[model samples]
Target: VWVRGALRFSKTPNGGEKLLAAASSHKCLIQLEDVAAESEREEVVARYFLKQGVQVIVYLGDITKQEADALVNAANEDLRHSGGVALALSKAAGPEVQRESSDLVRRDGKVATGDAVMTSGGKLKCKKLLHAVGPEKDKAGGRERELQVVQGDIIHEKTDVIVNSTGFKSEPAGVSKAILTAAGPPVQAELFNGQKHKFIYIHSGLLGCKEIVHVQTDQEAQATNKTCKKVLKLCESKGFTSAAFPAINTGTNFKKVEVDPNSVEYQDIAKGFHKTAKYKIHKIERVQNYHLWSGYFVMRRKMEMKNSAAELGEKYLYHGTSAESCHCIERDRFDRNYTGAHGASYGAGVYFAINASYSANSRYAKPDPAGLKRMYVARVLTGHHTLGDSSMKSPPQRGDDPSDKYDSLVDNLQSPSMYVIFHDDQAYPEYLITFI
Candidate 1:
């Protein structure tokens, strides 16, 4: 009988189809010859599996004879039951599977890499056999792997739920822009009506995904962390079996927010925003835990190498810096609320190197002033709007105050780890000192 492309199989007098028919019907083995042409490729695939610790044992005998739980077919790009192993399996499974595989592939493209299609074993010994393409075709491997961080298009994720970050007022432009844009007009309409930061919103038919979740939170690192925590809780509450978080505040792309600064979108959906209401994250307990962990484990080592680090421990009592660009000389003392007279600002985190150098500032501070372990560990937290040393030392900038001009020039941060604090005759620089 003709099969696949019909190259003609003249060796087996009984032919593969007849043998597979009997094997499927009787649930018995059908002794057959080796597939000389494709044996090398089969070995390669098996070797790949074996290297992954799968303990694969390739059997050259007919697959229909094997009584394993299931058998797999290395299908062509189209997944059709032409000649080769596919024809033998299909003939054994009866003619119906030709239609099954074709229709399924029609509905879902050629089974791509890291993907598989299942079929009833016809009359074969086992109940089912799976056909899959290998990772050489790594198209959708991202989904096949468990949870991972990727730096490409978020819209392509096939997970159950995708998390997009937005604020009470609106969805920022970064990944949120891509999400809402691909999500279509309905998602935009929904965003215009409410401040669902704490709440979750669901939409359909935007992307091919099963569902989309919009998380409202600040774009800051800690804020994104809080949004993630909320998304996890929402998943549990809604009984979602599986979920995925497309890069949130930090998207593979950039962040651009679209909001009618005066429109007040949240006014209608929720009672959270007003004309000038700023976004805030209250649940920082987890953030504190993380900062503390980084402080004790990661940053603590850096401090241990410093000569005068003991002095810091004695006065600040807390000398840990979370890797999130945070530099803490003293714990519990980083008054994120430090807004001195001239409208200067300081965040809960600070960015500083541990080099203990008298030099102004440097991402990699020069050879340690002392015999400290001069090493660059990570970026300390910066970007708190702290007006340079002048801001820390004087009153807030008033109109005609050159401090504003200096503020413009204030602490441009020569290095990734540059910030200025006051200097007492007895101590090191006291950065982030919003108050005199």
Candidate 2:
């Protein structure tokens, strides 16, 4: 991209207007015609004009102030709007921006690399001031050591080059050219290693009632870790090397536990799989913490319905008495705190179970630190077990009692030496699955 100048103007005789018009027309420079003002030239005044998509111009004696939609402040790691650019922005705007910035700082420990915070530009001409933290200024002593360690890792990882600059910088290393990009299905397949696994797609009642859809389930639901182990046995029987899984029956099936997709349940399962199986555990998720709970509440409205015999039976059997109601009858303390405490307990339970001792070789649940990761993975598989499947072909169905379901996957392993492949995603070479 380059800039091309058009024609220049004279220094006399109504030349300013003519030059301005000419400049606008040809995207040329507008200049004073002459020092000797002609009668028509006196009428020609330089009125302040701003145009869209036009380069700014300043006359020889004009003083210009930078006009921008907003100003950015370089804040400290603590997000304090203090000193240097921070002070400048604070003075321009009101103290409110600083206060908001401080609040945000308190909320998220230190601002990390490539992170930013926004605040209202109280009295400033700008609408907002975005606070950004640059890399740590102190790059000596310990900083150098840390940088060297990080640089060594990057180099060891076969990175081509490292670029450094103040302000804006660009690198020639195109992410698109990488051997594998951590996005879309290819990455997923690579992580999972073609592990034929199943997941229970459990939609919350709230999600089912919403006009705007929210939740989507995977394959099936397992009542406990036993179900997970059973599914792995099935996968092994089918000659699958590995599989990616989620907390099965626990999420939607188990009431009273608010199942966050990213809770400890998922984490424990991933870690367990990584620990026990010779496979990669690709945990695909996003951080949607508060939104899930809030959205659940917002979609809690009930719909009118005509009763059928089956519906009547369901109502009579499950919800006939207040004590036995299966549906979310009323917004109680449980619903209010489900997202935080209630959900957290369930997440913790799964985390504990996965982290607890287990013996995969013997297909038993014990407090074996060595087998915790495997147990967690087994738990995730349990989530995939379906109730309708026959026991002769499939592992036992998930029951309310978790102990019975424990280690079912290991017990049902078709071969003692079956291989486990940890694929990062599904698109990893299918040949890898065959190798397993």
Candidate 3:
């Protein structure tokens, strides 16, 4: 049995007061309304679990003022405690609560959705504060759409569509294999029997979903964004509202492999430098080959940058600097504060050169006491660039729209020899080479 509104003190013909008095003896779980303001008076809004021994009571009041042993705050994954109930709770609990939440994220990374991290309640009445990250609505999709992060098998999810990441032929591998196995033989037969396409939609035979979307994974990072947009468009066309997708290409798709000196990878890099080296070679020095790791944060920023740019136009470029600066760049990454160190001819940003000889000049690459010059072979994202001048600090607006801005600036649009990016993360130092 369920009850609504506050229990009255006056006796009723149905013996409601007797039932309410009996409920007072049992242990009750009090849940405060999330929308309630701090100044609101406490009142019983609803009740459940009448048949069971447990009593579930919903009260209209501020969660921070509750005398419960613990209080739960709806929080983001980062636990910034800057908005909504999180902000209110943080204010009531004191500064230590926010500080501890930040420290927790730094130590253990961001808390996953549907997971909760505990912290001291500080000045609050509760002894502990549980920061719970909940599923958020997909704002990009629509107000009616929600985005949830769930664990367990995707094949078991009951949705309109299930996305499977696979090769062109849809060979059974990784998540694709598991999905096909659960979907039964008909799905596999349709995938192999049909003409090869980038995306193939097939009927879900045994799987819980109504349909399956097989996406051919690409090596380029930009492909991820493109595939998502394509999938959403397809879903909209098909009138499908819900879909479940496995974490695509989050595994060994992109790995940092050390380029062996004898391997073709090393030779190709060496050839690039030698072909563009205007100065005559005196003596060849050491070339240390190390592939930069693309961690989670880096990949996330890359995707965002790719989506903003008209054309990703990624290229292998060179950056020359001192030995001390090289060490700092490797450890701390590129710093925009040091922009214009060589000269902001294009813009006040980190500059990269298509020709290694340009960066090899002493003006940019300072010689160490040992007489060796250092340079870096970096992966630069020269996206949707236009010719720039010293007056500009950032990329200019792409067109009439102020919100739309160019990703980077170039020396020349038709044939860009130099690229300047205001964003530090736009360029990653992949290989550092030392020479005479």
Candidate 4:
């Protein structure tokens, strides 16, 4: 928790915007040894060398022009390299950066807020590039008023219940300490008043009309989804309209994920760490009718579109044929100009019924949103024999008879194993399975 690097760096007024600009623009080439020598003697250079971890070294410098083991690109949810660091890294690393980033997005869904991915660096000096989607940034003056993020001592929160993260030998640590200190000795006594299980929901007079939910974790480093879900369900069932959750994991685990507080990755991890708080809060909102915000707003939009398709009396994919298909129409006319209309699926290999919506585009098919239906190719898998020399680009050439080639292609298509491929971004949609 203590930033030893900051105190050593801040002792002298070495860091500022001006210094960073000058350091980056310096024409003189500095070698690794020279930088190292300087760091040993010069305090500023020493500051540049941040945390010397067991495996990783966190540094503060121009990421665009740094000699590192790997550089991370703060990517969009779709893993597109856009403006700022993303754009700079793109220009430095070239097209392969975007391609590899795309592949990761293709395999996995939109990179989660805290998830980190590694890809080839392309033209960059580093050995690899890490792509991660940071949490959505606060938009304009809207964020502060919304109060989605609350920072301070957890004990001070005047809510329905302040969630006490108690797990792995609970005496008093972190938020538990603050809560016990604030709420007189009676609250602690009430917590243990015949609490049989890990999840203890106790009514407390010390913390006013509120109560306390002391939850035991999975005893692992990270809190599981089940644990987080339990807390939320308890809040709704108990009718605690408002709840404040402290940081879940503190002293229990021997390991800690350390990152620079100012960095994008760190912020994302911090947001991820407190995801329980966000999840629990929203569940309470829906239960108490605190607000009319939907948890699945994006899906709701897709449902509206599906309803539009249903009204047109279009045949569902599974109705006549075993296959189902949907073209991603432009959500609005304004979205027509955009390319890279990626496609996704609801199921792993199959697109679920609900998956017909926007998020279903796993392949990121950049279809003309204006076009009602794009050309989807009928795919056939090679059965029994693998085409060792086949590229599937143009028909096999090299003195092969035309009739033989045609017969082979037909045979592959007719094979029982040769079924249609789903959620494949690389495979162009040459055959139309239309709803309209």
Top lDDT model: 3
| lDDT tens digits by residue: candidate 3, 43-157 | 7899888776889889998888889898889999999876678989998898778777877887899999889999999899999999888886664354565567673346657
Model 2 Cα lDDT, one tens digit per residue, 1-436: 1122222334356755665776699986544343343222323234454666555444332111234565567777786555655666665565466556656765777787668877776777666667777776443323221112220111113221211110111211221111111122343243235332233221122222111111122243444445545545554465443333322222221123323333333443333333534533323222121222222222111111222223211110000111211122222211222112112211211111222222222222221234321121110112221122112222343568653332112222332211111111100100000001
- 193-219: candidate 4 lDDT, tens digit per residue: 555577877765345337877777565
Tens-digit per-residue lDDT, 1-436, candidate 1:
2134222443556665765786699997654344565443332234335556776565556676556678888776577666678779877776456656765776788887767888777667777778886664335354332345563356656666777666656445656665666665677777767555555576744564667776656657887777777777676677664576764344433221222222222122112111122223111110112222222322222333332344223121111222222233223223323212113332212323222231212222222343221111222321122345433443244358453311111245443233422211111122211100
Tell me the deviation in Å of residue 237 in model 1. 4.3
TM-score, structure 3 vs. true: 0.39
Question: lDDT for each of the candidates?
Answer: 0.44, 0.31, 0.73, 0.43
Candidate 1 TM-score versus the reference: 0.26
Cα miss at 257, model 2 (Å)?
Answer: 54
lDDT of 3 at 21: 59
lDDT of 3: 0.73
Q: Which stretches of model 2 miss by more than 4 angstroms?
A: 1-28, 31-65, 140-436
Q: Pick the candidate with the highest TM-score.
A: 3
